[model samples]
Target: MAWSFWQIQELNKNYDLTIVGAGFTGLHTAIAFKRKYPKASVLIVDQGLGVNAASNRNAGFACFGSPTELLANYQHLGRDAALTMAQKRREGIEFLAHTYGKACDYVPVTSHELFLDAKHDFEHVVSELKLLNADLKSVGFATETFKPSLNAQLEINQIEICGEGQLNPAKLHNALLDNCRAVGIQFCNAKFIDHQLLQDDIAVELEGGMIIKTTALVLATNGFSNTTNIKPARAQVLITEPIYNLQLEGNYHFDKGYYYLRNVGDRVLFGGGRNLDFETETTTDLSLNEFIQSHLENLLRNKLLQNVPFQIAHKWAGIMGIRQDGTPKVEVLGNHIFRIEGMSGMGVALSPVLAQELVELL
Candidate 1:
């Protein structure tokens, strides 16, 4: 395809920094970088025209860490590493709240981790709550971060995590976009194909036969990254039709946080069954899996809603970058090229601080 003179002229423009992927990391990084270096020419290129994947597709929980999930982190990562992660998440949450304020519809709510019969031993989990709470307290959480639930309506063994919340992810995306634009960050709607390092710059090739040059490049593709260390993990979700007089109102998780459910107003937003088919769910495809979808519906009906009446409202899927430590992977591929991915399904609570770190590196 032949390019017009104006298009060719635009392509010739060089940016001090060109970031690929307009998700949370990219936008936040651009905002932070622009704030740090106001005179630098910055541009953000994204595949999606609006609110790129994962950032707007998340469940919108503003939680730092649940009891069971933190426990798993403690077992896998060492104590110091786990505590560090928890502190980072807490810092991210605080930053998000302070930055966006009430513009994102953030509502403070308690978090719960259900202990299912036969699946999880109540005594074993409750016994570990003290240790978990102590560790979390060291990271600036409440002294009793995890405690036995007192809500009698739950009708099961559960642990309550204090001071967690939920919010509108779409609103947060819009806020980021507005902030980036206000700070003079340019945007291009195109898919990134590849990049090549030059003597003093990097040339990025995008879809539709355009190559742009920049002094530095950042890859925040996350789940969509081509790096071997960051693999895509698809999370399928379904929400029920608004039920009259719905009682469930807070964020919840079970089965080591593979299954999560929350009440969005009167409707229940349920997701997670990748553990059922890990091999197939490890893909970038946004298409929902029938096997996983069916499992989620079954749990929603029998385990969650029970006799309550409701109808399936909608179904969707989002991809997340996964790693063993559930932390952001920052790598410097070259002097001018850097890559940031592997949020491990915690991108929402991790991106803000990661972006700051990237800006400092620059």
Candidate 2:
């Protein structure tokens, strides 16, 4: 549906900045900019309902990476690149905590990935430790989480702890939205943004065919970002109805970060598996794919929750924008337009940090 510009009986006011998408990135960017220049007129426009992207639809893990995930990271991008990426994520999580605090259901539980294989891969374990420890030492940190004795408890394969964290994305979004309102930032419920660029000023053409002119423009709408250079990836997730005496703690990632599950009180929230059918999952639609949902349920029933009993209460999907070029963009695209995105699936932590970074640059 196209946007019908506010039928202002008709009067238009100039804005200093206009942000696209009210997701975390867009909302945070709005707050960040308003904070720096209180006198600036800031407004946000989006095509969807408020914060409906991955920002609110995520599993809420406030973490950097799982151990084996980091080892795989090292293999893919080498030690240096991997550590740099890990460090940014850690900092991003810290920034999120500082920004929202416990009122947002921000819990700091230690995340541990269990390695339970019938056969022990001690060699793979040693290689993982060497590379991971080197990466950690690069930042003057250490994790004895992989030490043999305790290692036996987690037992099975290679392990390394990235100290990743989790949080309630919706709660965080609500807080940011509240903050933006309190500070007097203007926001429209929805806008199509048919065209945008900075010739002299940022011009955002809405689906309603109304053109809003602002001094600058920021693109923060993850996944559904296809309105511009940003591309959306659909992520499907399922949650079980409340369970009794569920002992799951922190966040857990399996098969790299492709499969993840964690306890949200008595309910178990789990998602991921885009690796199963990347071709189909690469979409902006929030519709569920039966194949992914069935795969998730199968993994839960046969692998993780074999001994546990539960019933699925709800299932839904969210869109996450991929940094297709391998770079999470946060730079000037034109004279006064800034594009900030590409957090992969970890927007729970990365978005807020990118917001602050965007503000500093502004």
Candidate 3:
């Protein structure tokens, strides 16, 4: 496609920095970098083609580390790395609380982890909780971050944990967008195709033959990133129509955090099950998976809300970036180009901190 002078003049604008992706990491990175350099001209461009960004579609659990998840991390990444992960999560949550405050609809409700009798006996779960709590205490968290609890309504063994909460992800995204605009940041809606490093600037190629030039470029596409080390994991989620006299509250986790449920007003929001068909779920596609979605509905009907007559109000999926080895990627790809991704489904409580780290590289 040949670019006309009028079209080129209208579409091409040079910026001090350009960020791709409009999700948490990209938005936060833009805000942090603009704040550090108040006069810098920043533009954020995203494909905005579908409901693919996990930032706005996640279950909104302001979670750091669930017990079983932390235990697995400890086994896989060593005690020090696990502790570091926990600490970073805590810090990220704190940053949200301090920075966005009530704008995100944050509710510091008690978080619960349910152990279905079919999967775990009470005695065994208690032992695991003890070990998890002890490890948490070593890093300034209360020795009893998790305490034994029961949900008599569901007849399941559970544990209550502190220092975790829930929020409306959409609200958080809006708040970030508002802040970015308030700081004079610009936004463009376009499909990114490729980029080239020039002598003095990077030329970003968009669909329809549009090009944007910037001194620095940042990729925050996460799961959609075309990197070998990172893979996209699609999380399937559903919500029940508001049930009368619903008693569920706060964040809930089960099956080693592969499945989760929480109450949003009288509606129950639940998600996960990528573990059921890892191969199929490991794609950037946002369509629903019948097998995983069926399993979730079964759990909702027979396990989570048994005998409680309700109807599914909605169903959707979000793509999250993950690494095979369970490590985050925040590094420079080349001169003046950076990659900040691979949250592995923990982007909610990790993006803020990771965004700051990415800004430091600038």
Candidate 4:
């Protein structure tokens, strides 16, 4: 179903607890709030029909921070902070599975990526592995091993696979919505603004010139974090029509997982490479770019599916929050409003954890 301006405007009026942005974070936050205070009014509002910024747009891999990702984050932060963030993502994924069963198509596949080409890529992976192994082994969570195989059918350079996985993105979001509804959580297509904390109520103004009087307001916008400085960056995606005798399987990443593709039965879904053009791809817009699209296409032609007869069936983009610290901003906006944006590309694994934190904060 689609929405009209009037319908959204009508939903803009008062509520006890109004959650902005009905993505994974928002939906889960709504569920948490309802569970904590069953009699309290809990409403979720979004500008769209509860589609995720990157939630539905993600590769759906139940990952616990890839090695290079951890290394990159470690440089920005430190070893302890990066590992803590990784653990938060780790536990968050566990909670999601506990909340929504594996029938959501949540499968744990090979998590570590291969750096088959580019000397720099190989070196980076090695460095990342060194740091990560030290941390993982400290707690007996290490799962790295050196192995070689042509399983991917590519003349790539290395094979480092273990402890990674994939799932259906839209299914996760829909399941979350289903559970929220089951718990009597109400949602509407509305936007929020103008947070005013009164002596007794927190007044939130909507775009429709109406106000929502809630005891608490929470922000779970993730990459669509336009309400504040939470900048959600765009990542594009592509899909290929069902193919015959495809060799791709499991969640595989190359070039530091900047490029990823996996098979959903017979169809192949691929994304990433925004790192090749950061400035251009770093936008909140839900549109695709020619340079990155062409780059991915060329990779398919020259690297993966060379000369294979296949047609591009779909092309789209999703938003991921970005910040100096690679952590979702889960803090109180004021006395009554709280912010939970910036999932950093790890929203799929991290947002749910932040949602639980939001519940605690409330």
Candidate 5:
């Protein structure tokens, strides 16, 4: 694909900042940078037509962290680090709601973490619920954010309710794109190939020999972080046809947040099963795995929507970036290049703040 003269000139325009990957983080980072440096030329580029990652494909839970997930984070990253991460997520969700407006079909519903019999320590989570809620309160979350309860009808040992919500992912993405464009930020749908550090600028090479030079660069590819410490993990999801008089509402997590389901109107949107095949799921491929898909279907039929009649409507997969420490990696790679990745499957609730944090480093 040879570029025309005008196209080449446009591609070669010197930008003050260039960001790769026009997903949640990339777009938000561009917005943040543009707001701070209104006169600076900013550009964002991505390979996909739209956000083809978990940003647009996520289950849309406006969640900070599930009880079990927070407990695990506390165990792995300790109390202080976990609290900090939680605070970021909380602030991120609030920022998103504020920016996009509450009319983006966001529902303030209770999120639940369900534990099956003898599978997890229900009492242990119950014991720590108060402590976890306190930790959240310390970070500005509402007190008693997590509480223990039981729903025998759901066949669970225990359930914890918390302040979480759901939103329209597509709406949020489009809103950000509109906001970015309205603010005079340029976006190009080109795949980033490589980047090199020049004396005073970073030369970013896109596919087909197109190069974009910028004084500063940001890599917000998240799970698509090809060369960084971020590991790509694919999550498969399916939605069911509308069921008659469906009573389920709110978001749900089971098996330590490995599986999740939420009511999309009268239909149920279910996803997650990476734990069943971590090796295979740890890839950037946006393809479904029958082994995992079948398990999800079985779980949906036997556990989630048992005795309820419904048909499968759609199935898809999205990739997420995971880090060993379960924290997003946002750091300055050089004076001119910055890298942000490892959302650890919490990009929806973390990217907004992470983007602002990345801009602060500029």
Candidate 6:
């Protein structure tokens, strides 16, 4: 596609900043930079019509971490680093609520980590519940974070409950886009093909042979980073048709946060099962896997709904970037290029503050 004269002129003009991938992080980064430099020319470019990643497709979990997930993080990353990440997640949720307002349909409910069997893993989580709560409190949580509960009706031996919540991801994304536009930020629906760090500017190549030069560049592509270290894992999700007398109210996680489900009004939005086929799931392809999808359905029917009559209304997949350490990566790639990716599936609750942190590095 050849660019018109005006389009070519616009592409030739150097921008103050150009951000790639208008997902949660990109939008927020643009907003933060624009707020700092109100008169600066800022442009956001995304490949899809809207954010086609987990920003809109996520299960909308306003969570920091489940008990078991926190334990794993603590063991892997050590206590201080783990607690700091948890603190960032909590602050990110607060920032979203304050900035986007309640119109995002934020719902505060108990997040549960269910243990299907009374096994050693369950015992470890139960044993460390108090320590987890203490760690959360040290990070400014007003009260205890996790407590043990039983749900005999679901045939679960134990559930670690915490004061977590959910929100509509689509609504949040729309709100961010609208706010960015209101503040005079430009957005273009074009894929970013490549970038080069010039002496004083960065040249960004788009899909249609358009080259945009900017003083600074930010790669907020998250799961779509396409870098060597960052691996994209696709998560498949399904929503069921409205069930009568739906009892599920809060977000639930199991098997170390690989599987999560939440109630969307009277319907259940369930996702996760990448653990079943990690090799196949570690792709940027937004297609469903029959093996994983079937397993999710069986889990929904037998364990979640207890064999209750229900039909799946929709199914989709979203890619998430994961790092070796299971933490987000925000750093400067070059003198003029900054990259923020590898959310490790916690982009929903981490991107807001992560965006701020990334912008501060500018």
Tens digits of per-residue lDDT, candidate 1, 240-353, equal 999999988899988888888999999999998889999999999889899999899998888788888999999999999886456665778889788888887677778888
Model 3, range 82-122, lDDT digits (tens) per residue? 88888888888888988885999887888888888665555
lDDT of each: 0.83, 0.72, 0.85, 0.72, 0.82, 0.82
lDDT, candidate 5, at 281? 93
Model 4 clash pairs are 109-164, 109-165, 110-164, 111-164, 116-157
Candidate 6: residue 317 Cα off by (Å): 0.7
Lowest lDDT block of 10, candidate 4: 1-10
- The parts of candidate 3 lying over 4 Å away from their true place are 1-12, 121-125, 128-131
**On TM-score, who's better, 5 or 6?**
5
Candidate number of the best TM-score = 5
Which 10-residue window in model 3 sums to the lowest lDDT? 1-10
Error of 5 at 285 (Å): 1.3
Clashing pairs in 5: none
- Selected candidate, larger TM-score, 2 vs 5: 5
Q: Report the lDDT tens digits of candidate 5 across residue range 78-128.
A: 999989998998888788777775646777788888786676888888888
Candidate 6 total steric clashes: 0
Q: Give the per-residue lDDT digits (tens) of candidate 2, residues 1-362.
A: 11232212232446888888888788778888887999888887766666366777878888777666767777777767777766677777777777786747887776656554645454566666665666676764554534332334233443435455667777887887778778977767556555456567766787767787888878776776664556677888999999888766667776667778888888888898888988899887778999999999988877677678999999999888877554464867777778887777767766777788888877
| Per-residue lDDT of 249 in model 1 | 82
Q: Output the better candidate (2/5) by lDDT.
A: 5
> For residues 91-145, what per-residue lDDT tens digits would candidate 4 score against the true structure?
7767766767464777766643665556646554665565577686554454553
Q: Once all C-alphas are superposed, what RMSD does model 1 give against the true structure?
A: 3.5
Model 1, which residues run further than 4 Å from truth?
A: 1-12, 50-52, 324-326
Evaluate residue 343 in candidate 1 and report its C-alpha lDDT on the 0 to 100 scale. 81
Clashing pairs in 1: none
Clashes of 3: 0
